[model samples]
Target: MTRLRTLLVLLVLWCGVAASALAGPIYRVTVDTAALAGQGGYLDFLFLGLQDAAPATATLSNFTGALEGGGVTAGDASGSGAGRVILGNGSGWNEFAQHVGFGGLFGFDVTFEVGGAAGDSGTNLTLALLDDAFQYVGAAGDIVTFALLPGQADGVTTDGNFATVQAVPEPGSVALLALGLLGMAVLRRRSR
Candidate 1:
């Protein structure tokens, strides 16, 4: 019975450690397309691609747009046009959206399917630009996807971390975890 109890406790502790280590990455990518808007032609186009080489590509869905002062009334199409291969990975493409009129900005969330159970730490945002006439007229605007490092709350923006992410250790969380483990040890000793 004592050995069983020790085994159970060890299993629980191992599970806790494994769970924490297994947590993956999730990013809320907000693209400020206000700059891209009204550049040459009407900025009515779609941007879509995968974060990694996974067959499952993430889609930036449910667009909500606005102009500087007024609402130009635009919406998302099903990205189903003669889209060209945007990413150099030979990733074929199709129109993801059209009539996404000139707006203040375009925001989309790309939840990365990262490495292992720890999830994707980073992925590339390979985008192709199409004209108002469904022609691949512009260059591919490829950018890297980044998420704010763990335990950070403010000050840093997710935008600037396109190239490299500054990840920091959460000291408070570590301290709390240590305290909890110590308390658990005390309880186990008392029960014994």
Candidate 2:
């Protein structure tokens, strides 16, 4: 009976530790496109790539994005590569006039998972607005390059240009800590 109890306690402790350590951090990246709304074209492409990132230290995965404000109507597509995410809207070959009439201040909300050591940091990604031909709009601030550091918020903005990196709070670690304490208490009581 004592051996069974000990094994059970050990199992609980291991589980608690595993749960807390295996979960990675989630970041919320927001991009505002208010500046290019009336620039004679609709927002066609939003690219999050590692073109200028520190590939050795930075890691990102599990991407999800959404369009906001009064500008998002119809026609949207998305895809992901090894370390990049591509979002598109409107017809191709149309140049930078996809949503010329649908011009309205809008923003993009992107959430992704990241993993890196405490000191691991740098520009991990860049957010770019491109035309149907995948050419960047010939305007300032159309390309916002930023980093998503652990436990820190980051942003780059210009002419309504904005990007915020916010970490999603996780309670698993706290719950695991509590579980560990409870297991320890029970084990002590049994020993006594």
Candidate 3:
């Protein structure tokens, strides 16, 4: 009877651990506009568009954006397509306007998750930078393509060029995990 009780408790704890780890994949794409500065001195607009092809079980959501230096999302450019421009307007071409001054950083991140029992075998996402007229501006290296396979432990691939794409833990979750680890370490030390 005692052995059966111990097994039941272990099973419950194992299930709790697995349930806590269950979640979709998160990716962070940080664009170094500074490297593309030679292509243009002023980044009038950043094309925050994504072209993706994913497994039927996979879906994308929770898109977030940030900017360094100066710029704003042009409402007109908020959609999925090759011509979408999510950054500054035509006025940004001039030195006086609010724009990412070539040397600034533009960040775009997305979450990919498996919505069905089939699971996400793989997914591809493409990101780009565009001009005021919604024309492609960056060079080959500046443009990045990410291939994510949720099935794998570390399932993110890229050309590894000028652009930066990485998997990051959610800030709140990471903080909580750090606190838990510290508490465990303190308890272990006290027991010793």
Candidate 4:
């Protein structure tokens, strides 16, 4: 009986420890499109794992005009319709937080300069975080996604970037934990 009780206690403690250790933090994802142009095309922003603590902001670091090469469609049928523009070289920064029970939140702010001759010069930015499969993980896995609008503000902006707390357990780990608990229970019953 004493041995069974000890096993039970150990099982419970293990579960608690696993739960706490698997707990992830909250993240905020944002996208800014202040330097992009509508004529040159739009830009897509992607984020992996972002925390959702506070002060979620996405800052645009650099912007370069699209490239000109052969086999390029003059008017591509893309989402923006301003034609496809390849990014030269740019960098940006994003920040967020992580907490227990809460998934994460993220924000992004991007700026784009419209092409001077296109007459469709505006910024189009989008901020988002996606998993390995590119699936939108609003409140599940560790990914965030952001979308920016053209001709919009040139600074950081917040949107409906909130996710619920999700606690997903691994199949193997859960099975092991359950088996351990069940073993303790069975032992207790046999001893009694």
Model 4, 1-192: lDDT tens digits are 987987777777677668644432222233232222232221224222112211122333322233222112122111111222232112232222111111222222232232222222223233333333444334233322332222332333333334221223535466667767887887789789
lDDT of 3 by residue, 52-169 (tens): 3232221223323332233343432333211222321222121111234355565545554432222434433345565555465665433655444445543444444446777767
Q: Write model 1 residue lDDT over 1-192, tens digit each, in one string.
A: 977976776776676666656543333434344445565322232223344432222344333444222212122223321222121212434223334444244444333223322232222333333456644433344333333222322122333312123333434446448856885887888889
Q: Flag regions of model 2 displaced more than 4 Å.
A: 1-10, 38-123, 133-160, 171-192
Task: Give RMSD to native, each candidate.
Answer: 10.2, 8.8, 9.4, 18.2
Task: After the best TM-score superposition of candidate 3, give how far the Cα of residue 179 lies from its true spot, in angstroms.
Answer: 6.2
75-155: candidate 2 lDDT, tens digit per residue: 222332222333321222111112332234333334434444444543333444655454666454354444455445554
* Cα-based lDDT at residue 127, candidate 4: 35
Residue 156 C-alpha lDDT in model 1: 26
Of 1 and 3, which scores higher on lDDT? Answer: 3
The residue pairs that clash in candidate 3, if any, are none
Which regions of candidate 4 are displaced past 4 Å?
Answer: 1-16, 23-45, 48-168, 171-173
Clashing residue pairs, backbone N/CA/C < 3 A, model 2: 42-99
In candidate 2, position 15 carries an lDDT of 83
| Error in Å for residue 52 of model 1 | 13
Give all candidates' CA lDDT scores. 0.38, 0.44, 0.44, 0.33
